[model samples]
Target chain A: MMNIPEDISPWLAIPVVLLLIGGSLITLIGTLGLLRLPHFYQRIHGPAISITFGAGSFLLASMLYFTVLQQRLVIHELLITAFVMLTAPVTAMLLMRTAVYRDLRNGRQSPDLKPPTPPASGHATTAGANSPGLMEETRDRNPE
Target chain B: MKLLVEIALYFSQFCIVLAMLLCMLRLLKGPTAQDRVLALDTLWICAMLFALLLGISFASLVYFEWAMLIALTGFVSSVALAKFLMRGEIIE
Candidate 1:
């Protein structure tokens, strides 16, 4: 995989190297966190770093390296950066929400799990972990 | 400097490959469905980064497009899976 072209300047290469190595290392740590962290919530944070800084640096390095090599601006990587940034949080939030609600549905207890906010102007306290509220039951129509 | 870049690229490639392996292990052994989905999301990101690294080492432009397409579709699948888990339906 060492097919990087010649004639590239040293100055352009240094930052690329630093960003590449640092980002890769960060991603490794984050993935380790996903695997080794004791809980789901803690494990979730691990990949956050991967999707953000890790991918960010890799794309940035790709941009810099290719821009220097091709002798023109190569900013298309930004589209990826933007997509990741925009979607990452939504994905993470939805996954966390799913995890929490599933645990509640199955009555799986976790100290990390926080109680949902009580609904306004209603007896929301009646909803227990195993017994979900009418609204929730209505929302999830397909029963397992 | 070329030598430094070469060495760094190799090392980074190795690291990302290792990271991808770790993510797969989590995907396989994650205690719950949500954990698995999260691992899948992370796996795609790792894969994308790996592609970018490959682009650098090979000096090819195709990997960049591959990375972009992966990035575009990965989030949708993750979100859809999570939605299915949450709502018991992907489209409803």
Candidate 2:
């Protein structure tokens, strides 16, 4: 194994350790919320929290640690950070839409839920009001 | 001192794997599509972190590239899944 010097200064280690610990704790909280939240819509919020901060912290830690060890700019971690920030919310939005479509199709009332208005002509029609499978199919076709 | 850092890295990896397992359980038990999607998203993030830890442990650049690729592909898949959920079609 090629030896990379273990020369990280205490100043750097402080933030690296803090980032790792904080990221882990946030992810744990998100998972707990996923398990404990009462409804799908509510539970979706849990992992969102994790991806935003949990992934962000770890990425930051990686950047800091590698930069110190290598004595140069370590920027690749940014790619992961950028990817997570952009994608997590989009995924959440799509899933929420799918869940809503399912609820509507089943006539399963979501308290405080407003009905979806009919789509304009050329927009895909909602499957028969009672068909969950068709609704799921529609969700699959339209990944926006 | 090197040994201590290795221990810390290993401990962090352990916690990450535990979180990944919990996320998997949610994925399997999810009552709604949204819950499953969320779990899957969490799983990808965990995987990326795991890859990074591996890179650190091995002191290799190769794992970092793999991690980036995982992050990229995971994003695309989740987006596709979400879009399908939204409009019932991925490409149309």
Candidate 3:
């Protein structure tokens, strides 16, 4: 086995240790939220914590630990960091769109889909006027 | 300091394992297909971090490569699942 360093200064070691622990704890909390939160949309918000700050802290701790130990800039970890940042939201949005589509297809009345009540002035832009199909669908559903 | 690092490593690993188990619970208990897909996405992410922590624990650069591969696989699988959900099929 390669000899692991045993003499990291407390200043450097303390923060890295703290970061790893804190990051893991946050990730645990996020996953707990995912398991406990009711409804698809509410549960959708849970993983955001792990995808952002949870992964972020661990990445930072790893980068600092490797950089200090190797005595050179070690940045390949950035690939995972960048990948997570760029793709996590895309995945979440896609899943969210899929969930919304599925709910609409089933004719489920999710409270989230309800557009705000427009004023009597009659100048409210239909919530999603850009999508005429969905707009018409919702209007038909709530013919008030 | 070495002992401290060791403790942190073990603690992080424990937390990640717990998270992974929770994700599995969601995956199995999901009332909808989308929920299962989301759980899978989160599970792979936890696995990736688990590999990374292993890299640190072993003091090997190899596990870093493993971490990268896991990340790539997680993103691809999640994207594919989401696309499948968007369309009725994956390949068209």
Candidate 4:
């Protein structure tokens, strides 16, 4: 087994401590947001905090600890980190879209009112009242 | 010094387990399918962290690898669930 020198102690310990505490706190915040946020779309922001910064910090701590202990570069942690960063936004986007679709299907308030009407159809048609076709259209336009 | 590390590892693991329990509460209490899916995602993250802590405590690389795979599969499943929620179908 390789040994890490004593000189590296201060450098390693501080960052590890920081990562551990910071990651835990962020995760707590995310959970709180999940619980406290009033609506599903609003609640979506909460886990983004965990998936991004919280996971990032944890991964940093792991990388530092293992690299120091093993006395070599440990890059496998990066694979997890990179996978998280790449997939988180995609998942969040999908969740958001799904929330919107569900709300629309149930005739709940539009979370955002900014999607201007299609140029050909100048007005935002209230799909709730008029057309079964509109429901099918929304589903088709944003297929799962 | 070994005892100190063990204590710290145990504490971290405990915190992660507590978080997972909170997530389970949300999963069970969720009023919407989307909310449950979010809780499931959160639970997966906690479990991955727990696995990492176990790996560190035991000085094992295999647990770390297992944690990585869990994260990957969790992401895929959450995305698929979200997609299903969106269009009421997962496949074309």
Candidate 5:
């Protein structure tokens, strides 16, 4: 609900409009994928797309729009793009591993996953179990 | 041009909000912990985009910082949630 400024020119408006519309549509499509996809593995791809393409488009548009409005380069938003690019993959990997680990613990062994050979020094038990007292359990299991 | 940009910005804002709503639905009814976490992460992205859209419409520089802050905290939270789910503890 922003009031449009009287000074913004068509040259600036054209790309900004296109980029904004495109980014929002991309975001909507991605979130729809997250909601409608039947399987979690398939669902993961949805947010991954938003994180990359959607973020890129929005940030680029912001940079373009602001640079025009202020008549100076405004690119601080690029840092957000960098931060997202670095952190999203790590979080997605961890979540996927958690799902796989929970599946293994519940005895749903798929053919593709070999039960991880126990790490030296009781690593698997503590990591494999979802319990509050896991730190104590790890210590008790590993005496050296 | 002014009218066109204004309408585009409004439409974009609406789309991002709707996307956030969809993400909220996933977060509420997701079948598994990982599913909920993924939904939450997607919600964070939607929120960040919302902020960027706001910045464009308002023609201000401050929303950029807000977007950056949201991105930072969201990243930390998503990573922490994923780690907690994976390791059974946050710090260990």
Candidate 6:
């Protein structure tokens, strides 16, 4: 395998390495959060953090590294950056909608239905709301 | 220096591998189908980044193309999975 030239300036290398490390760390933390978050709604936010900023830093570092190595502007990495920016949110929103659809179909009280109620009681009430009055009360509090 | 670059690359690779493993754990343990699908999407994104990091470390352009392909395929699969979840079937 060809090695990165030893003669490249530290100024460039340092920033590139920092970016790469920072981005990878962000991705690691985000994925860890994804695994640990209790509810799907909360968990949905975890990947978004990585997808937006984590991938961005990595792409920027790749662009700079290749540009320095090739001694020219390396624009191809831009394609991945732009494509990811466009697609990640779309995928996230679609998944969120799907989750909400599933919850509603099962008559479960989804997060979007309420602002920030305690999850335990919300779940309990929604689980056994044989009376429409309680459902109405939930809707009244949420208003959406 | 080459040492610094090497260190950064190795560290990034290690982090990404851990990230992918966490994503897999979520995928396998997710309570609902949508949760699994979301985990799969995140997993693919992590894989794409991993490929790019490898490309950077090896100074090989081939890995960039691999990364791009992974992104394309990952997006398509995720969209299809989401559609299936939304409609109960992928095709009408």
The candidate scoring highest on lDDT is 6
Model 5: runs farther than 4 Å from truth? A1-3, A110-144
Clashes of each: 0, 16, 0, 0, 0, 0
**On residues B1-92, what C-alpha lDDT tens digit does candidate 3 reach at each position?**
88888889899999999999999999998878899999999999899889888887787789889888998999999989988887888889
List DockQ for all candidates. 0.64, 0.40, 0.51, 0.36, 0.52, 0.61
- Candidate 6 is scored at a TM of 0.86
Taking the tens digit of each residue's C-alpha lDDT, what string does model 4 give over A1-144?
222234546666667766766776677678777777866767778878877877788888888888887899997999998888898888888887887777666653353444434445634445442345664555334211
Rank all candidate structures by their lDDT, best first, as comma-separated numbers. 6, 3, 1, 5, 4, 2
Q: Write the per-residue lDDT of candidate 3 for residues A42-118, one digit (tens) a residue.
A: 99889889988888998888888888888899888898999999989999999999887775565444535554344
Model 3 scores a C-alpha lDDT of 0.84
TM-score of chain B of each: 0.95, 0.96, 0.96, 0.96, 0.97, 0.96
lDDT of 5 by residue, A1-144 (tens): 575677778888899889888888988999999999887778988988888888998898888877777778888887898999998888888888887776545433321333434545553244643443553343233111
Models ranked on TM-score:
6, 1, 3, 5, 4, 2
lDDT by residue (tens digit), candidate 1, A21-96:
8999999999999999988888989999888899999889989988888889999999999989999999989988
iRMSD (Å), candidate 1: 2.8
Scored by DockQ, the top model is: 1
Model 6 residue A44 CA deviation (Å) reads 0.6
- lDDT (0-100) at residue A38 of candidate 2? 72
Error of 5 at A125 (Å): 17
Off by over 4 Å in 3: A1-3, A111-144
Per-residue lDDT of candidate 6, residues A29-51 (tens digit): 99999999987889999999888
How far in Å is the alpha carbon of B5 misplaced in model 4?
3.6
Model 4: which docking level applies? acceptable
Instruction: Judge candidate 3 at residue B28 and give its lDDT.
Output: 94
| lDDT scores in order | 0.84, 0.73, 0.84, 0.73, 0.80, 0.86
- Tell me the spans in candidate 2 whose CA falls farther than 4 Å from its real position: A1-8, A111-144, B1-4
Check candidate 3 and list the clashing pairs: none
Q: Tell me each candidate's TM-score.
A: 0.85, 0.78, 0.84, 0.79, 0.83, 0.86
